[model samples]
Each structure stands twice: as structure tokens, then as C-alpha cells.
Target: MIKTSFISKTVSELKPSGIRRFFDLAANMEGVISLGVGEPDFVTSWSVREAAILSLEQGHTSYTANAGLLELRREIADYMHKSFEVTYNPADEIIVTVGASQAIDIALRATVSPGEEVLIVEPSFVSYAPLVMLAGGIAKTIQTANENEFKLMPQQLEEAITPNTKAIMLCSPNNPTGTQLGKEDLIKLSQIVKKHDLLVISDEIYSELAYDESYTSMAAIEEMRERTIVINGFSKGFAMTGWRLGFVCAPADIASAMLKIHQYTMMCASTMAQYAALEALKNGGSDVEEMRSSYRRRRNYIVKSFNEIGLDCHTPGGAFYAFPSIRLTGLSSEEFAEKLLMEEKVAVVPGNVFGDSGEGHIRCSYATSMDQLQEAVKRIGRFIEKYKVE
Candidate 1:
């Protein structure tokens, strides 16, 4: 009999996702209004789903090129250039991935050698640090604060870098905090990255959902294109989360390295999903705008609701999340989340679960219906009013 202890130490030591734990609890309880999950509640548009159905009917169910269908890659390349002003050669510079999640994983695995350090900007997505560790690298963090709208500062980036640092994991319209990086900030940060000779795994999955200003890609910066690996997918922008399709666009050499790792592990992203994504890239702009506009309205409503309720939430520039300070309740982020769930039947993620910088905050997703958002806010307001010590 093999011992269970034979599991890799790194895998064994990894903590279960805090997001999943709360989501699971919410799933079991009846009538719980959940604002915990990051996925959009909207179903994939009928047209996109219909494309996948047509593909299946046409017997298009087989493996794609290890780098994904050339047509899809070409569409992705075209989209990046037209939309974000970032260009990539579809032939050798793009590789379709299982999800943006896997793109992040393989990018880290391909670049980081054992004992190398990857600087993560914290109050970040839960997966970044774990993926770095899985890649045999050390996860060093620079915590971003509210004063900076949770955007990573150049000084923080500079101070956090060391001789051992090889790369930085950056997410814009960030998870946990929906704040994004502006062009000026990216220009400053790119200078530091170039000076230090660092790689960037840029996650821009939320780019299309941005409000007011259009989202900026670090890859769009001059000279940063080769240094940046851009990861995006249909999930967020096109309301296709269940489709599980994503891609990584990078320099030819880096893309080749990532593709080598991906071929052995993922082979290629889903064929049906690939076809659907191709359809999406070709014609899904209207659907994306429809959803993004809805999210923006919800964002405006919820940001105001939280402030009115005394939570001090920062109005997010993009994404479907609102990070609100729960400090007045005199409870830790976890305590506030737990009590809110148990008492008010509203589920949200504890900010501390994201990182120490998230200690006094809680993340409320606005992806659900406006009715649900309204009710959740009402319950939260009542709960805070009744229990908050201040």
C-alpha cells in the first residue's frame, strides 16, 4: 500500500481556496444570496452556444492544433491588435489554454526556476501565489493599499525586487479589488521591469468589463511586448465561463516554451469551446457590450449602496466586484463574512483570505441580479447597524 504521505510537499501544504470554501457553504443553504463567486451569473449568449452546437452537429469534435485552431489564434491576434493595440503573430505567438487560470500556471512554470522569486501584487487573486510555488519559485508579495486604489506602485515594485526576483505576476481590473492600472502607471512600472530584466504574466481577463476608460494592456507599452505574457479569455468578457477556453499571447520563444508544457498537460483547449470562441471573437462584441453595460450599472448601484451603508467601498473601475472596508464592525474580514452569512443569509468573501492587505475588507460581487444586490445590501446594512461597535 502506498502511503498518502507520499504526496508532494508543495501540493500537500497548499491551502484550499477560501473562495471555494465559502461558496460551498452557500451552495447548501437555501435562500442565501451569494455575492462570493467571481463568475458572471449571466448565461452564455445563445448565438455563441449555438455555434458550439453547430460544430458538434458538423462532427467538428476532435483535437485542435496543440497551439489551438489557427483560425482562432488568428482571430485572437486580430482582436488584440484592433482592441488593445497589442500585436502578436498567431502562428507561433499564441497558444490556446484550458482557462486563463492554466495560462497563468504554465507561464509561471515555464519561466521560474527553483529558488527564483516572483513578486506578486497582493490583494490579488488567490491563485497567483500558489501557482508561483507550484512553479518552484518563491512568492514574495508587495501589498497594495486603498490610498493607491490598490494599483501597484512603482516604489512598491522597486522595493520588492531583489537579485533573486525573476518575474512579476500582475492582474489589472484586479480580483478582490476592481481597480486597474492606467497607462502612466504602466509606463512607470514597465521602466522598472525593464531595468530589472523581469518577466510579466499580465492577466487582463476583466479588460472588456472596464467602465469609463478603456482597459490598458501592459503588453501595449513600448518595449514591454516581449516581456509581457497576456492572458485573456471568453469567460469574463463574453459570459462564457463554463466554456473553459483561454489563450496566452507572448513572445515567440516564451509562447513556444509555454506550448511545450501545455501540450503535455492540456494538449489543447476544448474543441467545441474553441469553435465557440472563434465565433465569439468574430461576432460577440454586442453581447459583451450588453453584459458589460449591465455590470457597470450594477457597479454604480452597489458602490453607492455600500457607501450609504457605511462600508466605505471603493468604486471599481472594472470587473464585477466591490471591496468594502468592514472595519467599523470591529470584526476581522473573516468574522464579518461568517456572521453576515450566518445571520443575514448573504455570502461574500473575506478580504483577508486574499492577502493581509485585504484584512479590513470584504469582497461583494455584483454579477448577480440587481434584485439580489439590493436585498444583499439591505441585509448587510441592517446587520452592520445592529452589530457594529462604532
Candidate 2:
């Protein structure tokens, strides 16, 4: 029998994400009403799909440049400018990645030295901590509260930063919580980060999906712009998750450094995905509007449904999730989710799937249809009611 060393231990000791565990459970079970996945209900836009097909038919299967196709990079540059008012040269300031997941991984690996600290706010997207650990960096989690609308308060941030801090991740329109960081919150953070001279990794994947207010990226700030790396993708905005296309925009030096790792690890993202993403940039605004409007409808209904269950949910300003506090049930987030699934056959991810700060909440995705939302609420209500009685 072979024994694994510390090299293998790094990967093995990593716990599988809770979202996948619940999903696998739901998959094997029949009659499950799921609000577990945080993806769009909408299909890939017609134009985007057509672009991919055309690329394939035109025999563009061969690899392009290591950075990516120049035209696609230009389209991405233009989209960033027109939509976010953020400018990049596209020639030297951007690198296409295999989804924002790979971008985050590459940025951390390239920038963070082993034994350095990467400050992450939680409950966060599950990938952050694990990825930091894999790169041999310390995953420093600063737990943000629901009372703050899950915003990373300046005090909390100040308390967390150390001399060894290499980077800090700010996920606005955050995963699980659906918390959108407004201008005021970001301005405060920008000031603090500048004082500390810390590198900022702003995950603005849901930049286009904010409901009450538009997103203000940390990189949008003048001083913070130089110190920040922006990660965005086609997944959240364009309903193109499977396409796995994302990009990173940073200062020329940072982009070049990130490109070295990206080139060595993933030569370039998919050729067809690049084509489809270009189409998303060119003509996908209306599709985004449609999905955003639909998600708003679902978000409103589910927030109401959760309130009716006596679970207090903060108003979600962006993304498709509602992170409702399940504290009233006297069950942990995992317990509530499990009992609901076992008894009512409805699947929702427990809040702790994100982090400890999420312990008393459960995350419900409004990315499903309204009819499904209605039925899932009914099942969830019944399950909670039964648990109360029991």
C-alpha cells in the first residue's frame, strides 16, 4: 500500500463543497424541488450559441494566441468600458481565462507567496479558502454579518489585515447572500485598503445583475484601481456557465505576471467559448436585461415567501440568491436544509456551505422559474411547519 506525503495531503485534506454534496443527494432522490444551484434559469442567448456554432463550422478549432484571440479581447475591452466605465488597453491589460474560477486561482498563485496571508470575507463563495490553501497561503477569513447586509465593514477589515497580508478578496453581489456593496461601502473600503497598501481581488462576476443599485467595482475607484485585480465572466451576466469563459483586467505589470501563470497552466480558454463570449459582448445586453427582470420577479416572491415562513431575509440587491436567517427554527443551517429535503423533497444549500458566519441561514436560489419557486416555497413551508410541530 502506498502512503501519501504532504504534497498529496494538500488536496486530500480539502473537504468537498457542501453545495455539491446536497446536489448529489437531491440527484439520487425523486420528487425534489431544488433551490440549491445558483445559475440562471435562462438558456444561452440565441446569438451567443450561433456564434459558437459558426466558429466550429468555420474550422476555428486550432489554438489561437496564448493570451486569446485579439478580436475577443477587444470586444471584452469595449464591453468593460461601455458597461462599467473601466478602461483597459486589451493589448496588455487583459487576459482571458477558463472561467473566473481559473482567474481567481491564477491570480492567487501568481501574486501570493507561500506562507503569505490572503484575507477573505465570509460567508463567501466556497472556492476562495480552498484555493488559497492549495497555493500554500494562509486563508484568513473575516466573518461579515447579516446586520451589515454582509458588507465587509472597514473596522472588520482593519482588524483582519496583518503585515503578511498579500491580498484581500471582495465579492460584491456576493454568492449565497446576494449582498450588493454600494458606493459608500466600497469608498470606505478603498480608503482603508489604500492606507494599508493591500492588493485587492475584486470578484465582480455579478456586476451586471444588481437590482436596487448598480455595482461599483473596487477597481472603479481611481487609487484602488491600480492596486486591484478585477475578475468577471460570461457565466452570471450572459447565462453561459458551461462555456467557461472569463477575463482578468489589471495594471499592465499585474496582467503580464498573471499571464505567465495562465499561459503555463491554461494556454488559452476554449476557442469556441471565446467566440461565444465575443457574441455575448456584442449583442447580449437585451438577454441580460430579460434575465435580470425575471430574477427580480423571483427575488421579490422568494423574499416574501421566506418572510412568511418567519425567516428574516435581508433585501438582496443583486445575484439570484436569498440568504434567509433560519435561526427561528432552532436548527443549524445544515439541519434545516436536510430535514426540508428529507421530508418535503426540496433542496436548498445550507448557509454554512459558505462559512461560519452563515451558520443560521440557508441560501435559496431564485434562478429557477416562478412556478418552481412557488412550489418549493410551499414544500419548505410545510417542512418547517412539521418541524415546529415535532
RMSD of each: 1.0, 1.3
If candidate 1 were superposed on the true structure by all CA atoms, what would the RMSD be? 1.0
Candidate 1, residues 1-390: lDDT per residue as tens digits? 989698999998898899898898889899999999889998998889999999999999899999999999999999999999988999999999999999999999999999999999989899999999999999999999987789898999999999999999898889989998888989999999999999999999999989979778999999999999999988999888989998999999999999999989988889999999998999999988999999999999999999998888888889999999999989998889999999999999999889999999999999999999999999999999987885
lDDT score at residue 68, model 2, on the 0-100 scale: 87
- Residue 92 of candidate 1: its Cα lDDT? 99
lDDT of 1 at 325: 92
Error in Å for residue 387 of model 2:
2.4
Give lDDT tens digits, candidate 2, residues 129-155. Answer: 999999899999999998888888899
> Whose TM-score is greatest here?
1
lDDT for residue 117 in candidate 1, whole number 0-100: 100
Model 2 accuracy (lDDT, Cα): 0.90
Per-model CA lDDT versus the true structure = 0.93, 0.90
TM-score of 2: 0.98
Misplaced by over 4 Å in model 2 are none
